[model samples]
Target: MGRSRVALKFNLGRGVLLAPLIFLTIFYFYPLVSILSVSLFPAGRIDLSGFSEIATSAYYHRIVWFTIRQAIISTVLTILLALPCAYLFARYRFPGRSILLALTTLPFVLPPVVVAIAFTSLIGRGGLLNRLLMSQLGLSSPPLQFEQTFAIIIIVHVFYNFSIALRMMTGFWMNQSRRIEEAARVMGAHGWRLWWTIYLPILRPVIAASGILVFIFTFTSFGVILILGGVRFATIEVEIYRQTTSIFNLPLAAALSLLQIAIMTAMMLAYTRLQRNLPLELQATRHTLQNLSTRRAYTLIILLVSFIAMMIFTPLLALVVRSFMSSTSGTFSLRFYKMLTVNTRSSILFVPPVDAIINSVKFAFITTLLASVLGMMAAYLLARRGVFFARWIDPLFMLPLATSAVTLGFGFIIALDEPPLNLRTSPMLIPIAHTLVALPFVVRSLLPALRRIPPNIPEAARMLGASPVSVWWLVELPLMLRSLVVGAVFAFTISMGEFGASLFIARPETPTLPVAIFRLFSRPGAESAGQALALSVILMGVSFVSFLVIERLRTPGTGEF
Candidate 1:
């Protein structure tokens, strides 16, 4: 009877595993394989020529070099900027500190296109900085022309990714053992020596993890480059879209896609290894922020806070300001907001702009439901078991997070066109793709909470004559409710702001908010630009509310990203 029960349990676990495995295979792996096959067998035969052409071409070589260079520069700049802020947040408490931290994270949830537009509004040729410079200097032309430059690209990448470095490193730093630092100080190590010998070694792993994540994100950047960098600059992601959609070069697109996936997969593997090797005891000790005590400290803190405030808030403020300004009057007005309700016959969009909000919210709701359910199951399985399968399964679930959305969207176009699972024109594909991207976040949020539940609580319930299902429903469910909410919010916001996949899959008549904003920006005229800014403000509002809920619900010290 015991043997039979063990076999039953094994079968149940295997069945649970099969659901996600099949979903990933159909939606993720199959699409990837389709792209590879198209590239390698372009003419119903094996073709090594595409790979050779990519390798030998000087244009492709320059692109590859630029991608790596920009990513590295962005990563370094983000870390440098984020370190001081992280130190301040981790070690010093002040008025409105939590609010400041939350504000710093706002950019993370904004769409890359919105971010690109915001930066352009602040520093483009006709932007605020140039206008100010021209008016003050009496120049006919705008002097600060930053558009399409390497410097502008790097600056925007840092703006978009700085929060990751800040949050991750701050959480890690707050939980670190301060005894090492104290010990080094006592042993005559001070200033740079103390940092170089003690803090640096302890923080290396976290820095590495944060750097790798930032690099992966910047490497796959698409919307930002496309909107801000213009035709002169293209990442692998932007080039993939151009090659596939505009130029109709499928073989080259597939080859580039393959190269991107290979590099990202390697980086993800390295990140997984680093995470595993991180010291478990680093989480044992916790630190409280200290009150500012010295004049020097106050000066430093004020300067850092001001810099962070300016860096994060300026672009958003500019965007909001631009949204209200009327093109004809050059004064603040509600014209753009009112224009969103109008369904002009001459509009490029098939539907009114307001309908895009409805579509975005609808898709986000469905994505939250699907991602939460699947992510909960995956997290439960990993937390409840300590088997060989669990070891490999964790990384497999994270693969989607590391994969480029542009590549995944391209893959979907090619792979899901046939009969058994045709989803080409189906609106359902947007939610499905969004769910894939959001699943990793949901799993990350829930896994920690699930793991925190004491094993004895469930065992105690069983001892009191409760069935396994009853124990799970009565105990585990209640305990994990907050985390579940956090996960759902994350999934919702991700779906709402999703741009890359939606770009490929969305129909003309049923555009989501991000898609609508992109469309608005694609057209010329001040009216279109104003509408784009207005829609972006709406998207930003939604994301901010979602993030506030996440902040209220998330457990302290649990890393979000």
Candidate 2:
């Protein structure tokens, strides 16, 4: 009787595990594998012709080099900019520090379309900068036209990715016990020597991890390059979008997408190799914030905070102003908000910003649900280390994140758009596209929670003759509810603003919010443009709400399931 109960418990665990595997096979793996096959294999044959076109084409070679070079510059700049900020935020306590941290993190989550429009109104030819430059600065010509330039691309990329480096480094830095630093200072290490010897070495793993993540994100970046990058530049992602969507050269687009995947996969593999030797035993100490009292240190901190505030707030403020104030008419009106509710335009592509809001909310909710469930299951299975299909399944979930969404979108166009699948035009495709992008976050967020559960609890429960369902219901599930909720929220927000994959898969009738905002900017008319800005404002609000809600949900003492 005891053995039979144990067998039943094991069977229940296995069944719970298999549920996610089955889910992935249907929604995630099948779509991704099918897409991969379609991209590389031409019709009935495996061929190198697609790759050959990419390798041999001078245009593609230029794009590949530009992509690598810009990403490197962006990564390095982001690290430089983020490191000091991270140090300040993690170590120092001051008035409005929490507010400052929140402000810095705000832009990272805003929709790419919104960011692009905000950037355009600030720096474009007829933008505020140029107007100020010509009128106030006594300039005959505009000195700062960053549109379509590499400088613009790099700045935008840096602005977007700075938080990645900051968050990772700050988390790692805050975890560090001050004892080592105190010991180093006591041993006569001072100034740069202290940082060089004590802090740098300790921060190396975190730095490397953050750098790798930022590099991957910028390397495969799509939306920034597409709108802000304009005509002068084309990354592999932009090239794929242009070739496939605009030109209808699906074959060439597939080739470019495959090349991008190959490059990214190779780069990730190299990073993994380097990261393997990194020591993980350095644990963090519990933190209580400290004040910067020294004259020079306080001055420096103030300067850094001021610069970050300006960098983050100025463009966003410009966006807010443009959303409310009229640029073309040079007057203020509530028409933008009204237009958001009532689509006054006759364009076939126009979705009222209000409708887009509903669509975005629905899509985000579905994505959160699907990604959270799959991720929780996968994390549980992998945490055990000896679980069935663990090794094979883990990498598959991460592929969507590591690979460019443009590549995946291109793959989807080729694979699922056809008869055997024919899911390309389905309204559900956008949610699926979002889930693909959000799956990695789900897995990463849940892994720690899963690992925190002690193996002994289940064992003890089983020894007490608890049934299989009861053990999990009474033991494991209780510990995981918070993690699952946190992961779900991340998945939702990520999907809501997701742009790259949506570009290829989203149909005209069921456009997501980001897609709607882009369509607004694609043509002319000041009212429509302001409506887009207002919609962007709405997006920013939605993103902020989601982020705050998730933070609250993830907070300890709050029961979230």
lDDT of candidate model 1 versus the reference: 0.85
Q: Please write out the lDDT profile of model 1 over residues 1-561, one tens digit for every residue.
A: 569657866886777687777878888999999999999999999887767878999998988888999999999999988877777777887777766777777888788879877887888887777878899999999898888888888988999899889987887788887888888888899978986898678778889988998999999999888888998999889999999999998889999999999999889888867765553635567877689898877887898779987999898888888788777776889999988976544756457789999999999999999999888888887777466677678778878878999999999999999888899989999999999999988987887788778899988997797765788799999999999998999999999999999999899988999999998888888877888899999999898888877877776556545
Candidate 1 Cα misplacement greater than 4 A, ranges: 1-8, 279-281, 293-297, 344-349
Model 1 vs. true fold: TM: 0.96
**Top TM-score prediction, candidate number:** 1
How do the predictions measure up, each by TM-score? Answer: 0.96, 0.91
Sequence-dependent TM-score of model 2: 0.91
lDDT of each: 0.85, 0.75
Candidate No. with top lDDT = 1
Write one digit per residue (lDDT tens) for candidate 2, span 1-561: 869767975886787678876765765556556555655675767867767777798978899999999989999999989888887877877876655655666677676788888888888777778878899989888778788888888988888888767866776677678888999999999989998999888878768767877888899888998888878888888888888778986667766766677777766655544433332323345566778788876987889778886787778877887788765586787778887866657767656678877888899988888887777777777677466566555565566777887776776666676676788778888887888788777876676666667788888998898876788799988888777777887788788788778777777777778888888877588877888898888887777776666555553211111
